[model samples]
Target: MSSPNGASEKQSEQSEAISSRKWFARGARAAISIPAFILTAAFVGYAGLARETGLTLLETLAMTGFIWALPSVVVLTGALSSGMGIVPAGIAVALASVRLMPMTMALMPIIKVQGKTKNWQLLIASHFVAVTAWVYAMKHLPELPREARLPFFVGFGSSISTFVFVLTGIAYLLVERLPDVVAGALFLLTPVYFLCSLWGAARLNADKAAMVAGLVLGPVFFISLPGLDLLWTGLMGGTLAYLATRIWRRGLS
Candidate 1:
């Protein structure tokens, strides 16, 4: 009947299909979680802030839809209103997004999605890109089958985008009705949720090292260089963490 090779090929294809389905399932779970809910609240706060700061609703929505990066949007909007040149505002936006490069590198291996197909997925995925989704993917993808990674990412990304779209619209309309305290509390959700997620996800020596380095360096760098604080803190702290890990591993060996 069937040759062994043919049977093996069929089995491999089936395995891949199964893996893809599992990835999507995991992503669906994350999409409906507390963290995702917090992200939506934070987006609402961002929309309110944009309106309060005199940005047009259309501009705010455009930023949410296209930029999809909160910190960058904040910096760009603030810089523009402060009379900064367009070039400087653009640079500020780019600098704020530098963290994504490291995030992308960390996720590339876990995703294991390859070639031209992956390119298109990446383009679509970038629209919903944010710190939360990246952290979730990094934490969960390694434990999943290879074929599922893309689907999982798609699910999580789509969830975040959908929530941002609706919540942002709501925030724009309701900003005036919401109390200042409530708006401030909503704005705090993103950072708090991110720190909690980071703590929960820090399973390895490298993660611990990085966290410690960031804790020590972030405040110091922030006081010294307000505008470039994140960039400098991340670079210096991450490098120190890497060096420390290497030294400790060598000593153990």
Candidate 2:
């Protein structure tokens, strides 16, 4: 027969496990929302684009599953289609994906448990830290228990990722049936959502400043330095915003 302490510990473990499952289920259900739908729509456009770019269905699905970011997919597909070699295409994809690093960083503190959350868990969770999932987490995590946050995010992220993956295949098969205008419009939805989300979620004036600076410089750089426009825009715009913020703070003090 088990001792009373052993029984009590076993009961506690079971309760914790049940609670984790409940949170996971809640997150999966939450995946059926506007942002997730927007992500799905973006993948529809990605599917069509992939087809047009001569990628096989398998390749399209592989990219969706592995990359999981619309911008990275676009950059990789664009580079490959333009006859850029694998090395250059990979570099372009890496550059496009670098923007997500901040999102992952912002989320770490929110979901991390002081002693309970393991590094391996975080390493896995970080892979799912894309735009839609990060935005959802920011909106909902504070209301959740710290222990529940990681499971909830993994559930939400995995659910939406799978949902998009399936739809991307369907869209790929159906792209020939979709009109060019419709496909193009669908493909543009994600970036629009992305911009709106950033503006809405920005906590600091400096964040907004960087965005505005990027907007103003984007067109100018596109015309003058099309090849490295994005890189230059991000570097210059972010630097300008940082300097401005510092100057404003110094003046206030």
Each model's total of backbone clashes: 0, 0
Model 1: lDDT to the true structure? 0.79
Model 2 alpha-carbon miss at residue 73, Å: 0.8
In terms of lDDT, the best-performing candidate is 2
Residue 53's lDDT within candidate 1 is 81
Tell me each candidate's TM-score: 0.85, 0.85
Clashing pairs in 2: none
Cα lDDT of model 1 by residue, 132-162, tens digit:
8887877877786666677889877886777
Tell me the spans in candidate 2 whose CA falls farther than 4 Å from its real position: 1-6, 204-206, 217-253
TM-score of 1: 0.85
